[model samples]
Structures are given as C-alpha cells and as structure tokens.
Target: MPGVTDNRKSVLITGCSPGGIGNSLAREFHQSNLRVLATARDAANIADLAELGIETLSLVVDDLESVKACFADVETRLGDKGLDYLWPKYVNNVEDTKYYTVPAMEVEISEVRKTFETNLFAVITMCQTFLPLLIKAKGTIVQVGSVAGIIPYVFGSVYNASKAALHSFSDTLRVELAPFGVHVTTIVTGGVQSRIARTQRTLLPNSMYTPIESEYSRRVTHSQHNAMPHDAYARSVVAQVLYGPAPWRWLWPWAKGRKAWIWEGHRSWLIWFLLARGRPIAAAFKAATGPSVQSRLAMQQKRNLSIHEYLSARLLKTYGIGVPNGEVARSGEEAEAVAKSIGNDDMVIKAQVLAGGRGKGHFDNGLKGGVRVIYSPTEAKMFANQMIGHKLITKQTGAAGRDCNSVLICERKFARREFYLAILMDRALQTPIIVSSSQGGMDIEAVAKENPEAITTTPIDINTGVTDEIARTIAIDLGFSEQCIEEAKTTIQNLYKVFMERDATQIEINPLSETSDHQVLAMDAKLGFDENAEFRQKEVFSWRDHSQEDADELDGDIGCLVNGAGLAMATMDIIKLNGGSPANFLDVGGGATPAAIKSAFELITSDPKVSAIFVNIFGGIVRCDAIAQGLINVVQEMGLRTPIVARLQGTNMEQAHKLINESGLKIFSMEDLQNAAEKSVQFSKVVKMAREIDVGVEFTLDI
Candidate 1:
C-alpha cells in the first residue's frame, strides 16, 4: 500500500517462509529497490520480510479462490503499471509427502497426486492467473525446477516426475508466451541450503524400502551441509531475473539473449555437463539402490562343499574306481598297524589336512614334511607321531596352519604314466564337462595358464552321460597303454557315475595313473559337492571338518552372514572394498530357520575381533520374514553387543521389514548392498576405536 503511489517494479513471490529460497529472493529483490511481495500460507511466517519494508501476503497457491484474491489485490495496487516478475517457488510439507525420498513402489498414489497439484498444476494455475498482468508489463515468469528432473537420483520417483513435467511445461510456455511479450524462465536448480532440506522425512510404515530408511534420510538432507547458501542463490537468481534480458524488442530480436533455462546452486555445472554429453546417470542411481556383482559372486562361492582327500578316496572306492589300499590313523600305533595291514614294503604317510601342497608343507612341531615315504612300520610310526598333532603349513594355508588330526597311510604304487582328469559343471553350457591334460602331478592352474594347448575339455550330455566311446577316446587321448586303456575307460565312466550320483560339483584326479603292474588307478583325488545337495548327501556332509575352514573367523573385524555362497562372497568382497575385514563367511543355508540363524550369530560373535555382523539374505527358497524373526530372536536371546546390519530381499520382504522395525533392537536394516556394506564397515571401525580407547584407559589406570 505504501509503494502503490511510487513508480517502482513489483515482484510477487510464493512460499517465502523464513530461511527459505523464496524468503531470501524477497530480501534480495527488496535490496535491489524493487517493491517485493513475499507470500506464504501464513503471513506471520514472513513478518521479518514485512519488517524490512517488503510487502507480505498470505496466499495458498493450490486454492483457486486464494490465487484470485491475491491477483485482484496486486491488480488494484499496480493500477496501470502491471507486475514485473512472478516467482512461484514450489515447496511441499516433507512430513506429509515424503515422495522426494521414497521408492516409486512405496510412494502412495494420493501423495503423488498432491505433489503434482502443488509442484506442477498449482504453478500452472498461478502463471495462468498472473499472465494478464505479466503481459501488461511484459514481465518474466520464473519456475523453480531441480536437476532431479533430468538426472535420476535414488528414491525420487514422484518428485522427479513432477519436476520433469514442470520443465516441459515451462519450455512450451516460453515459446508460446514469446509473441505475447511474456517471458518464462525455468530455473534448473541443484543443491541449495534451505529449510526444506532441514525438514526430515520418513518412509511409510509398511514401506518395502524400510531396510533403506537410513539412505532415504541421508538423501533427504543431502544438500543441507555442502549446498550453496539460500542467500547466495537468491542474489544470483535475482540479478539474472532483474536485468538479464528484455522481454519485448521487435527492433532487435537478437538482443533477447537471456537463458530460457538457468542452472544455479551447487553441482549445477556437473549436471549441465552430464546433460550436454547425454551420459546415463542410471549407473550412479543403480549403485545406490541395487545389489552389486561382487555380492552375487560371493553368494555363489558359498554353495560349494569341499571334502578331505581321504573322504574323496573313499568316494572313489565306492564307485569301483581303482585306488591304492589306504587306512586312516589318529595315532602313531594306529599308523604302524595300518602300515602292517597294507602288507606292502613301500608306503606313503600323508597328513589328513584339507589343503593343497601337502607334500611341500611343514609341521609346526618341527616336522620337515607333511607327506613322507617310509619303507617299514617303525619309520611310519615315527613320522605319524610328529604329524598327527601338529599344524601343517602349506602354500594354501597361511601362517596359521591347519591341524593334522589324522594321517592316511596307503601302499605306494609306482606310476608308469600320469595324467590329469576332472569332471566339473560348466556354468555357461549348463552341463557337465570332462577336463583332461597329459601334464599331471604338478600345479594344475599353472599348467593350464602356461600350456593351455595341452588341456582338452569335453562337454558331457546330461541325458546320455559318459558313453563307452567317450571314455575310450579320452583314455587314448591321455596316452594310456594298450593294456590299461580298457581299465582307464572303466575308471573314467565310474568317475562320471560318482560325479552324477553324489551330486558332485567337481571330481579332480591329479594323477589318473597307469601303475607299474599295468593297473589304472586314481592315485590322488579331490571332490567338491554342491552344498545345496546336503539333504541327500548326508554322509558326505558329515565328513566336513568345520575346524579346518573359515580361518579368517578369528582375525577379521566384520562378520558376514549370507544365505548363498555367491552373495556371501560378494558381501565379503564389498566389505573389503569398503575397507573392512570380514571375520567369517557363514551361509545359514537356504532354510534360514531360527536355529540356523541363531547358530550363525553365535558362531560369528564367538570371534572377539568381530565388531559387527552383516546379514545379507535373498529369500527365494525361504521367507525373509522368517529369517528376520530368527535374527531378532537370536539378538534378544544372546544379548549381542556387536552391531548388526541385515539386508533381506525377495520373498515377503515387506513383512520382514515390519518385523525388524517392531523388534526394538539396534539392528540396522538396509536395502542397498553398497550402503549396507559401508555401514557395516563404519560400525566395525567405531567398535574397534571404542575397544582401543577402553584398552588405553585401562592400561593407564593399571600404571
């Protein structure tokens, strides 16, 4: 009312709450000597602006009557000279509509409609209502947009869609309004520090994204810390809006050099560059929302079940494959008795440890070798005494070697010719394949790398299996003697039977040998079974020595509990990638029952170095809700102090989220693999730091 008689440019701005972009814009425009009208839902919110000689109004942008009343008031104040600028700053209550940080599936349809009403439709109504005044003065319309419209960030589906629609509308409006002498400028904003960013948003109670609630919170206030100040943003925007361009100039059309789309705020340059180059931002989006390849590989690795050499030999014997007579011994007297029972002058004693390079390994009890050849029972006894209770360190075993709980004493056989043969599943072909090489009794991996040409692979049909013709051809190719060819063929067929019948993933015979007596024998064997087949292969699984495996369980900081081997391996790889050491890799199996989950937690927490536990489960065979209940039960029962990060996906995940949230425990549920891994690593570091401080304080007090 005071500036109604004066000849000054007037600008009306919406959503001018304190500490907001609209409020700062109002102040900036007022400083530039313009008659600024700052409006909010409540006029009292912008009283500070009114105190600074800026006109304040209460205008609900969404209400048509409110828009009409505000427009009529402005029309009376301006009289002949119309409004110069209209800034419609779209701002919604974050608490009511968390569509900005919620997944598309989890966002309510009603909230989506409300977002469009406020962000797009209401703004359009404002422009339509004020177009007459804007045309009278040849003024500009500034539509506040965001980079999220063009670049797809995580968990911003509805909000991004609304902004994108607004941008398109502005682009068309800019061209259509050119002839009317009313310019429309869409401000493509990046991160700007404002009150809206400070407002915390939460996911819906039944949200599928409940696991990633922390990520949503992080993204909601992401711009709060490192964003450009609202005042700074306001200064730049006002400067460009006021004197940047002429709305109507028929004499000089080229003089209209104002940007139709103005990019401002922090990271605006990066957004512009990305847009210009047409690069896909989906990868960046996926990195924050989806599971990684490393996690999948880790899960696959967990399903493999490897057995000891003696067990493998026993399996080979069961299949009627030729092997040297051998017996397991736990003590020196037992080894001597086994040697005598064999009734052979020459015998070999091998430490029963689950690792490669046993021949080249040394015992921790000052024994020179794990595998030794003896001519008599007395010599066998002496070597067995040294190896039975000692840890055998090999290339495969690190400094902390595997204990030799028993030894295998077998009658020695001289090999006339040695060859390598193996039956394994070919993942790509989805069938079994036989791999063979003339080179044997050495490192198979090195041989494959150095002399790849020497190796031969033959895919086996699942229906027909290994035919006599296939086995004979393989025997001849391996250079078996004419006398041993039939025996070799039989052995090959039997090995295939063992592979199929036992659900074996891999059966590797390092030396399928032709003995001095022209006997074809499997001299040394290693078998790996599919862990998923544990129900059927109970006997094979029974031979599993848990003590000899998962050596890192004692030393690592983060304990991993994953359902599948591939996922488990990926979890571990991601943990290491994020600078956290995995203390143990435990697959609770596909069942994921309460007992299994409880056992897994107990095992993981047993290691004092495990500061945090990461449970990454994909519930395909098992329900995620079941696993979640089990996890809650374990934590409450055990009273676990170590922090747990559980990422459950697949079957009944929504129910799982509900169970976890209602559990009232300190466990963190995460949806993104990368975020979960990073959180686990962070928790581990915090725990370690706390422990170190406690130790330091205790040491000082002791002194």
Candidate 2:
C-alpha cells in the first residue's frame, strides 16, 4: 500500500530551455500521466514552463548557495511529499538538462569547474539529496545522452564530455539501485533536431579549423545541417524514459535503424562487389594503407615543445619580466623617430612578422629591406613607414600577405640579465615545478655554463594553497627577504593554479628578471596548452599565436586517411625517410576508404619529393582483403607501375595475399619492419633489379 502511491514512472530531466528536451519531456510526461517537475537556471527561462501547470524552479548548478535554495523551494512548494532533485553536487547535466562537456576541450577553468559542478557533481548531489524520495517512489531513472558520448568530433567537445560522464554515472546508478528496485536507462541520440542544431557553429571560424583547410567544406557543412528534428529525438527520449528494458543502451529506430543494419545494407553492397571480384578492392586497400602508416609515425616524431624565439619575446614581457627593448617601426621616418627616442644611433630594425629569418636578408649589408641593422635614426624611421600594414615577405610566409598586426615598440635593453628560469613540468616530479637562475637573457645554455648551481627547482601543491614552508625554501635560494619570499610564493602559487586548473600543457618563462631595483619580472613567456582542453580555458585559446605554430600537414584534408598518431607520423617520416617527402598527412581513422585513400595519395604525392609511393597498412578492424581490393582498384585506375610497395597484416591477410600475389607485378612478401623498411628505402634497388631482370617498372623513383 505504501509503494502503490509512488508507483508512477519518473525521470530526472535536465536542460529545461524553452525549446529543449527538459521542457518537451515535462509536457510529454504530464500528457502521458506521469509526474513533471520542470527546472531551469532562471524561473523566467521557464515561465512558460509554469504555464504548462507543472513544477518550475530556479536551479543554478554551479553555486552551492543557488543549489540549496532551489531544493528548499522545491520542498516548500510540495510540503511533506515534494522533492527528487536536491542537487547536492554542484554539477548539472547538459544532455536532457545540461550542456555537453569534455575535460580536454572545456577550458574556461572556471567554466569547466562550473560545468562539472552542473553535469557531474549535481547528479551525485541530486541522487544523495533525493535518496529518501526516490526510495519511496521506486521509480526508474532515465538519463538523456547524445551520440557525442561515444564519437569524437570537433567543437561540441564540452557537450560530449558531459554526456559521456553522465553515461558513466547512469551505469553506476543502475548497479547501485538494482536492489532498491530503481532502474536506470540512458538515451543516446544522433542528429536530433534541437535549438542546439540551430545554434551550433555550422561553419566554424578559422580558429576552429585544424591547420589544414577542408576541401569538402560544403559537403561537411551540409551534413552538419541535415540532423534529425528535435521532436523525433524527443519521442525516443520519452519512450526510453517511460519504458524499462535497460540492458546497456537502447538505440532508437529499433531494428530498422540500428547502425549494424544500415552498415550492412549500404557498405555490404560495395563490399560484395569487391568480394565478388576478389581483385580490385584488395589491391586498393594495400595501396592506401601503405603510406598512411608511415605518415602517422612522421607526425609523432616531429611533435615537440621546443620554444621559438618569436614567442619567447612576448612571454618574457609578462610577469614583470623584461626583454631587449625593440621598436615597431613601419617606415623610415618611424624607424628614425624610434631611434631618436632611444637616443642611440645604433639600432636593430627586424621584420616583425611572427616568423624566423632575418640573417638571410634580401640584399647584403642588411640595408635593402626586410630587416636591417641601421646605423642612424633616419634609416630606422624610413623602414617603419614602409612596413606598416604592408606584407612582410619572408622565406616562410612567401610573398603572400602575413597576419602581422602589432609590432614590438621597445627600447633596447642590452644583456644586463641573461639567466633562464623556466617553470617546467619535470615528468619525474609529475607536477608543475619551478626552475630559476640568477643570470638572465640571450644564451640560456651559456648561463648554465658559468654556474649550473644558480638554477633551482621547486615543486608545489595548489590545493593546500601556498604555504610558508615552500616560501622559505625559494627565499633562501633567490636571496629574498621574508616578505618578498612570501609575495613570490603567492605569485608562484597563482601561476601554478593557472597551469593545472586551466589544463595548460606548458608555461615556459625564461629569464625571470631580478631588476636592478630588486624587482622581479618575467622577461619572456612561452605557453602551450592542451588544445583538447580549450573548452574549459577561454584565455588559453585566445592566446594561441599561430604566428609561431606550424600548420599540421594532415590536419584537415581529403586523403586516404588511416588513424593512429604513431602510424600517421611514421608514414610521413617514411616518405621523407626514403627521400620522398610526403605532400601531407591524411588518416581515414575508422572510416578508411578507397576514395579516401586516393585523396591521401594525391595529397601525399603533392610534394615533388614523392617520386613514387610505398603504402604499408596494418588492418585490425579493417580487413586486409578489403585493403587489397582498394589497392587493385587504385592500380587499375591510376595504373600499376606507379611505384608502390605494400605490406598488409591481420584478418583476411590470406585473401589479400592471394589477390596481390596474382596481380601482374610480384607483391613483395616481406616479414617485419626491417625488410619492409629496407624494401621501401631500397625502392631504387627494387626498381633496378626489376628493370635489369627485364621486368616492367612503372615510374622511376629517383631516390
């Protein structure tokens, strides 16, 4: 009799915007004769929600104060019987009720903190707070999720992150609530037509673009806009919430739209044609996967954190640090004026585009243009006006216009301090640690020479906050007074907090200046944050100086793409390794296709160094038989003798082996990386032997 009153099905709805799931669910639940307690950040955001004659309340997930108040209001409204969502945890759910969030992409440190409070902690809080009510009700708990919870896409990172976290949370809830008669079900939808679709960045800004520009921007853009309507998505959400067949996940479209069904119907046809032929598709797979592996490995090898001087200049200016004073002169007059202000006849007026290259100036004597070491103020001023808003051509940017906006307007500070104090993450310490020295400026290595003992490393924990103990250790080394040491500790602590909370990868500060007046300034700063952590950090993304960042060859392109960072980098390196520089890096990931392979091949061969090509593919989920057919097609379309070497392993290898071995040219069967590497490297040897033996050689790879 006690449980009968609370036998109605219920859900913890999230994201109760005007046109959102929560509101829609509220209306649906009420219409279906189930209980509805609608909620939103602002009561007015859901005033119309009130018009629906259901529960509406203000619940700000981040602020504990707001959370406590919202629950109290809920209890007051219902009296004796009310309440399921007390929200003890600060996190709010973004799927049905909250926004999507990922740890790496969510970067506004505070926003990330807030998002977690809403999406994650709030779930815990609400569960604990409503434990008594939920137990009494004996109802099923429904959590809304999105496709992003599984797939990795660009942008929507934070939203996806939150949903994924919720998915995990729901799983835990299901296990824990099993004995208490509480059932948990998750809804994972794809292409839901919602306000999110309308508001989503259809054509993201250049900032969102990976280093490479997309060739299929139109196709990609169109696909993005073609998502399913919100109502259809809502219906499924309601069904899952009201029903209780929860095993792991419930994909909508029932038997009709299950991905495996669609994949078989669609891709199977293409696969069958290849399987029937047993010739073309097998060839192409071998061909495409060949270069992809090498490209991935090359990418990994070159990824480094070495600081460029251009970035070093600005970072040194922050933290009260100082670098050599420089002038932002465009024309000769401005250069002269800047020189006059300095009152020094000798001046170094360098090209201000965020690039490297000045010593290799256009003309000798360092005077014609670009960057010149002028002896007089008039000469400096003359160079300034000429460069203002004008393209500064260098070997790197070529003749095209550069994105140069500001010039460093500074007075020269000649070599007074030259010590390098870099606060680096010594993986050994596995934390943000400090590195300092007495010397400042110029050659950091030279300073390391004069006195290596001058440098000191200090580790700190930001949670306990800055303490007096660490302050004393640093003070003793830097020779600071107790007060100054305490101040220094506070600064260090703040900086460390910035590093961890913000998801920064590295914050390199070189030459922490101990000015002549005993004042400390950061002479230069070189900061790099995990790009994936951008969602949580607004400032980190804003500070991106593409001026110093090189474009990734495989970033955004149409190519015979394969996935795996290590493999992609290696493929690129191999091409270069074999004296054939890859045109670009393109990986197909889980969606590797012959067409994609063609695109990758085109992009890779775009470089003249790619005389011919060698492709090595390790098909794990992708069957080697499919890869072989792809290669066979490639050779038939593009013609064999395009100078290709392929080594394929994993499932269907036998079938693939049969296809390649039977193809006109002998598909070299080499075991292990040693022979495979040597085969590609010794393409000349292969080519010469085949030629000497009077075999047909396609193209001459001049390696």
Candidate 3:
C-alpha cells in the first residue's frame, strides 16, 4: 500500500484493464493532472499504468473483504486528505444467450446471482466502503451504466436487469449523498469502443440453448463493432465527470454518438417489435419447469405479430369492415380464373408479401410492382405469372426481396376522396390514440411531419371506447361530409371493436377511401396484433408470413452492410441527411467471416433499386483485410456490377485498403465517413441517370 504523498486531485478507478473503459479513463484523468489510482482484479494486469506513473492496486471488487482491504489500504495511505473521486465502473456481461433465453426458472440461480454480484452488489459495496473518504473530500462518484439497463434486449435479461438495478441505486445515491456536498452521477453509455469484440465469450453449450445459439449470436455480433472508440469515449466521459458543477445524470457528450438511438423511441420500438415478433419467444422457453416463468414468458412472447394485406383484410371482414372482394391465387391460371369469376371488372392483383411499398416494387422477372391494376384477365394472368414464384424487391424488401408464393386478386375500386386513419398504443399517454389525416396514401408519416396540423390525434379512454361523441369528433376532425358522419362513426366503431377484441397493437387504414357513390371502404388495411396475445389469438399468429423477413433487413436506397445496429442506423441517417436514400439495413456483424461478407456482398448487389452500396467497417475482432477479400471474391465470382463505396477503419485498415485497391474492381475506398457517404450518393445518382438513358439498366461493371 502506498502512503499519502501530495494533495493533488485524486481518482480511484476500478477495473483498469488494458483496452478497457477504466484504463482509458485513467489515462484521461491522469493526463488532466489527477493523481490516479487504477485498480484491477490482478495488479499485474495493469502494470503498464505504473510506467506512466499511475498508482496501481489489486482489488477484487466483487469480494467484500477485498473491497474493504483495498479501501483500508487507501485510507491508510491518503489519510484525512481522502479521495477526490471514486469511479465504480466495473461490469460483467453474460453473452451466452442460453443464460437468458432459458426460462428464468430453468436458468441456474447461481449464474444470475453471480452476474448481479459483480454488476450490482459489488458497486453498491464499493460506494458504501468508500463513502467516508468520499464524504471527507466531498468527491464526485461516477457510475458508468449501460443503455441495456434502460432498454433490455433478448439474451441480455440478467445483465440488463443488473445494470437497471444499479441505475436505480445511482439515482438514490445522488439524493442521499447530496447533503454531504458529495455528487453522484450516472453515465448511461451506449456501445463504446472497447475490447468487447475480443472479450465477448461464446455461448456455453447447454442442451436448452445449443440449438438457437448460432442464431442469437449472429443477431448480436454487430453491436461490438458499432462501439465508439475508447479514446474518444473516455475523453468525452471524463470531461463531463471532471468538469465543475456536476449534474445528477450526464447526457451523452458527442451528439453523433450511439446514445442518440436510445432516445429515438419510435425507431427503438420498431427494432424491438421486429425482433420480438420474428422469433418464437414462447417456444424458446417452453422447457421452463416453473409455472410463473412460463406464464410471464407467455405474456411477453406474443409481440411482433406478422400479417400481410390479405390476412389483415380478412381480419377486417370479421368485424364488418368493408373491404374489396378478393381471393388468394397461387398460380397465374388461378389468378385468371379468379378474375373471370369476378366477371372481368377492373381488378388489382397484389403480390402477397409482408413488406410495404408493394406499389413501387417489382419482381425479378420483369414484373412491375407488387400491385397492378388491370382491365383485362390476360393482363392479370401475365402479372400473376411474373410475380408468383419470383422474387419481389421493394424499398422494404432489401436486395434479396421475398418469394411471391401467392397473389391477391381484389376488385379495383377508385376513391373520390382518401384519408389516412390509424389506431395505435401511445407509449407517452399509455392509451390508444387515433391518428387521422385528410390526405393519405403511402406517405402518412411524411404528411404528419410536413403538415402536422392536417393530422389529428385523438386519445381514447379505455373505459369509454370509441363513443358516439368521440366518433363525431374524429369525423369532424377528418372533415367528413354531414351525410358521411354516421357511416364514418360506424366504421370507426367497428375498427375499435376489432382493435379491442383481437388485442391488436396497431390498426391502420391508409386511404380509408370514399368512392364516387360515397361509400367508405378499407382500401388498404394494416394490422399488428399484440404478440403476447398469440396464445389466446391463435388465428392471428397463424397468419404470420415468415418468408417476408430475412435474418435482417432495413429499408433504404443505399444498402448499408455495416457491423452494428447503432452504426448501421447512424450510417443510414447520415445518408438520408446527405440527400441519399438508404436501400436496406444490413449488418454483416463484428465477427463476420470472409464467406459471410461474400454473402452480404451478393445480397446487396442483387437489388436492382440499390444503385450503389456503402460498406462501413470498424474492424475490431474482425480483420479489415478479410472483409476486403470477401468483396474481392464476390466481384470475381459473381462479377458484381453495382458501384461500391467503402469506409474501412480499425484493425489492419491499411491491408484492407490495399487488398480492395489491388483487386482492380469497381470499388471506391474512403476512410472518412462523410466522404464515403457522399461518394456512395454520387455513384447512386450516376447509376440512376445511366439506367434512365438506356432501357437496359447497366453500370460500368469495372472497378
């Protein structure tokens, strides 16, 4: 133990391992002229810090006795001068999906307890043990928490819960420690650059989790690469923590950082909804031995209900909602027959896929759009033949698109007036809110953004439901004609009944059309049911079109195949901000192998709408050259013609750039993010212009 030397400002940081957050912060604080005491589980682990004149100590923070002894030694050394800062920033994460995917009752109690011991109890103990020293100096306590705590994800329940508990503790500590002139601040960080890619352990094999391990692991791999660089992260964190006039909570320092994604509630909710609905959470935990675990699991598992237009239309019909007469046809002959059976009236044939923007999508076999309005049975048969058994790509379908296994032949009805209407649960109000706009089609979100006044939002009380008063108010807000008010009210009531009875999360009728005859029709219906209610609503769950989804897909024009969800989204937003449309959201992940990269390359290039592709890689555990090689292999094998703009950073960056350059392919490299994005946009525009000039869409095809 070192004895008290000078009165310089001091900071004691636990878990100062190399390539870790604590170590980075220690360096940052030391550079700021603070007397730094960096502690780790093993003194030898942080021996390098001593070279920089930092005092190092071996302290197993999770063990109470170790914590006490460490504090005692510190007390003996520092004396009454005490400690100016105490950062309890240690953490333990269980990456094994099995630990969380298993029924809570089935998971070994010891495992969960151990995680809490390190992530939660130990932090609390360290604070308790060091309180006297901190109080004497009126020091600030910085607790580094994670966003995972605030928004828990699957396979991270235990770790997320522990951090959540710690967050609560930090809040309480801030209040309790205030009277002593002591400050407590919580830094809720998102993915920050660290050695996470190297340190993340593989899932330990258990019969319960082995089968689904690969799937979940692939799902989380990109998060590691999406982390903020440690130097930048540490500097940002320390600046906030050390600056005078401390607040109870620290906002994310860099506006461009990953933390912004957490507060974008709608975006985050969409991600969660997609993940929850796509997987069978109920089946994953069916082996749980306890009834409570099973029951709770059942309740939460019924999220992410998948329903296409046909299924949704059928659901509406059940509630007496007016829908165009339609019948499912699996083949062109079937579609023609269906058309003939309906007496050859103008008809709309729509591809039966689970994605949006079908009107603007096309099939690979020269079929234009998922929806086609035709006056003849021959045209219906031709469109059906082109769509059925062909891949249909839309802005939402990514490059690969989805198989058109069926088509819906519905009578085409023209609307004299169109309006957008939807009922959805409002998180802020904790109630069902009805959103309606006089103008509608596929761009309701855009209308809501640009002309919010046109969009009326009415919050409904659960007890009153959609009463006559509420219906009249909604109809008036929608500018419904006096003659149409009663009919509109009836439609609203039926929709509300469907929403309540089916436990639906969202009911949208875009362009709830008014025909020339003045009849209201559910022209296009989209319904999302509460996934948790699937057990009770078996009929709704049965309609899930799993084929419409890939392992991952996000809507955009410029395809993004980055490594982490946060980074992937950031890239997409940046593209949009830079006047570019993202073609799809594709995360190859942190540990993507050469083969995976090749697959990703092929997938992105296959999309006709994806004029250009952007590949942003922050190689942490993944070597940059491996990614370059994958790109090269795909270009050589498939002769990819799409323009590619890549930004490669991190491990073996030089080699990665070299490999791509030497390949002599039509790939452009830019290490800077903005530069790469601009190039991708320019190239995408070029692709668009060139295709317009020539009927046969083609690029230079050479690097």
Q: lDDT: which candidate is best?
A: 1
Q: How many backbone clashes does candidate 2 have?
A: 127
Per-candidate TM equals 0.50, 0.44, 0.44
Candidate 1 regions exceeding 4 Å error are 1-305, 538-555, 559-572, 584-607, 613-683, 689-703
198-245 in candidate 1: lDDT tens per residue? Answer: 556666787776787775666555334334577866765564455331
Off by over 4 Å in 2: 1-407, 413-418, 426-429, 446-454, 462-472, 479-504, 533-596, 635-641, 664-672, 684-703
> Lowest-lDDT window of 10 residues in candidate 3?
289-298
Name the TM-score of candidate 3: 0.44
Model 1, poorest ten-residue lDDT window?
287-296
* Residues 511-549 of candidate 3: C-alpha lDDT, one tens digit per residue: 898777778889998788876787899878888777765
Q: Give me the displacement of residue 81 in model 2, in angstroms.
A: 70
* Two-way lDDT contest, 1 vs 2, winner: 1
**Reference-based lDDT, each prediction:** 0.73, 0.48, 0.70
Q: Give me the runs in candidate 3 sitting further than 4 Å from their true place.
A: 1-303, 551-703
Model 2: lDDT of residue 671 = 31
